[model samples]
Target: MMYQLGKRIESIVLPVEMLQQLKPSDFPNQWEYEAWQRRNLKILEAGLLLHPLLPLDKTDTAAQQLRQIIRGALEKPLETGKNNKTMQALRSIALSLACRTFDGSVSETSHWADGFPLNLRIYQMLLEACFDVNDETSVIEEVDEVLELVKKTWVVLGMNQMLHDLCFLWILFNRYVVTGQVESDLLFAANNLLMEVEKDAKAMTDPDYSKIISSTLGTILGWAEKRLLAYHNYFHSDNTETMECVVSMAVLSAKIMVEDISHEYHRTRKEIDLARERVDNYIRSSLRVAFVQASFQYFSIMSLHRMSSTR
Candidate 1:
């Protein structure tokens, strides 16, 4: 029955129309939502088997260990703000915890050589791609080639650590760049920075150290943004609004980092800005009319509330 239900769910990718109407708060209890999540996870697991391009492992002990680590890490960041720093910390913690839990002896044996360099390289490549939109065609093709090489290299090296590192990197990049946050360069840098910061924090031994780690990293990222802006004229084209939008988004990302470290305010405003840009681009391209219509309806409702309040 579980397998059948999972298969059914896997056959359907829920439309944006359906997702827009969902409200988790409407659920009666935590158990109800958990059951939904478990079903969804099963569906995803099953779908993985059908994909020719993706690698799958049925007895993936590392994957099982990752689940336990993620549960613990998710709890830590609830009180911390939902900013970039906290998100990255949670990711790093989960990766470390997963390694420790999966193969306890191996985790101790390969502590320093696992996650850092791979995370750094991934971040660097992503950030570089954010700005390169020109006659430089086949960029994505090149990236895919490099990724294949890296995958092959990992197999040759016989290290499961690369798998965990890449999984976290993929999740973080997808969440911020491919889905939520839209400023490609900033999203790229932010994802990388989070991993880098987490690496540094792990070395600290002071009590109440997480706060110190978060604040210090937040400040450094903010400083780096300013440096990038100071040299922006050298890198950006004058007439390119898309590039301008990317730069603006990067600056806004720093504000999110600050909010996460200090808990000063929510950074939803920037997210809304990026969403607006994406929506406008979609409308211009006529690519997903249903999504555009739903967005318009949402905006109309909000605008009506504003006008009615003024009256």
Candidate 2:
């Protein structure tokens, strides 16, 4: 019965029409809006809370509710002058996971999918809930649980690239939050996942699915570039370090393309050429940004030195 329910929820992809209707006008006020989101959060929390007692179907219903809540939350804007960034992060993370589910890869989801559904399902839910309910120690405990789940389930889920990519993204988010850094380990994992997806890009029969996968990879790359720039800001005094890190990241990306995604694997010669050109352009743009930042820092330092010497 639970397996049937899991299958049913798995089949329940939220339609575009329903998504279009989940706008802010649907709610009367901020409190009620938050209440609706919290209710969805509770549904997710309850499913994980009662996972051992309930069947997988009920558990999946919780996952489905979480997915719906993410979609609804995204359509509506948050109230002004409130520190709801955590809530916003929850919506983004859950939406990424939701995207994975509906990308058609979940149809043949393996038993490995069942290994820790609750842990994976309630990640962002638990994190946002912690902001409301927990103290420092409790928040740390929740982070540990999510990280452990991420580490354990990561390799197995690579069998499904969509799942693997989003799951890796969740791991990257948590790592950044907990340690204030995106570890090289996480970046390498993401690199491998993107390469794996690209390797099969020519073989994917569904054009929509292939496009979605490519879009997701692009999003990951965007996130990475943003992180690099953010890290550089903090180390503006060390231009060498900034240049090396940013250039190394771009090079790592180019190296992955060269070594893994061969021309023969591409659907056509034109496609492979376009892919190579895109990576080259990305590297050049990244270096240009880095050079501009470095120039600004150098000029700032020189101005400060001149002022001090004049004084």
Candidate 3:
């Protein structure tokens, strides 16, 4: 009887689309609903049991352990018919949450492979809901906490680091878009992502990864353009530090374009090139070339001064 009950818990699957509409009040006030909540809570608890800081010496085993824990939660009786669609959704969410929470590897199992994109979309929707419903202060704190977990996970996964980082940055980017406040860490993550991608160029070839990367690059460039316009307005208001940071980011954006898209070696070079050109044209139309040149020169001089002062 206990075994059968556990299986029923695992079989509970919520559609990815429904996650956005989910609310604390949405929990049905009944014994079964309460049981379902408790089960999910336990799964989340077990998911976070292992330390994320541990060396990747046994990551494969860690992945297996996570999979087993999820499987254990999912154990069901033979009499309970399969809900294939719901199971797929649950498995996708489970694997994504497990990977995000535990720093475990993303399972390449058929279920995970088929539904990774949908899983990502669901996570983003949940995040958006979190921001929209909660007070900004609490939401920022919560989002930051969640993002820290993601950053830790990024340390463990080798093959999926780019995808994870892009997701992380996109969350921050979306946050900034919705709320005008910028997080410096988003820019920092962007820089690190560009460095990682440059070091391993093959990530550009994965269709899913490439699709997200292309869209994210445009979003980032758009943000930078907005910042540049702000700098242009305040150029005489003693915002040198802000101007310098914005210019440095723009330079990094250009470097990403030149290195990733412009390289003839990239498999999706043509599509990426067009994307880059679109962003460049957008930037050019919004800001002056001479202003950009001046900001770069100013940034360079500031760097030199800091170097001299340290010596």
Better of 2 and 3 by lDDT: 3
Sort by lDDT, best first: what order? 3, 2, 1
Leading candidate by TM-score: 3
- CA lDDT, candidate 3, residue 175: 63
Model 1 / residue 179 / CA error / Å: 28
TM-score computed on alpha carbons, candidate 3: 0.44
Best by lDDT: 3
The per-candidate count of clashes, in order, stands at: 0, 0, 2
* Model 3 bad stretches (over 4 Å): 1-26, 29-116, 125-159, 182-203, 226-230, 234-238, 262-311
Q: What TM-score goes with each of the models?
A: 0.25, 0.36, 0.44
- Which regions of candidate 1 fall more than 4 Å away from where they truly are? 1-112, 115-140, 151-243, 261-311
> Per-residue CA lDDT of candidate 3, range 172-210, in tens?
555644555444444454455655554544446666565
- Score residue 201 of candidate 3 by CA lDDT: 42
The C-alpha local distance difference test score for the whole of candidate 2 amounts to 0.45
- In model 2, the worst 10-residue window by lDDT is 12-21
Judging by lDDT, tell me the better candidate of 1 and 2.
Answer: 2
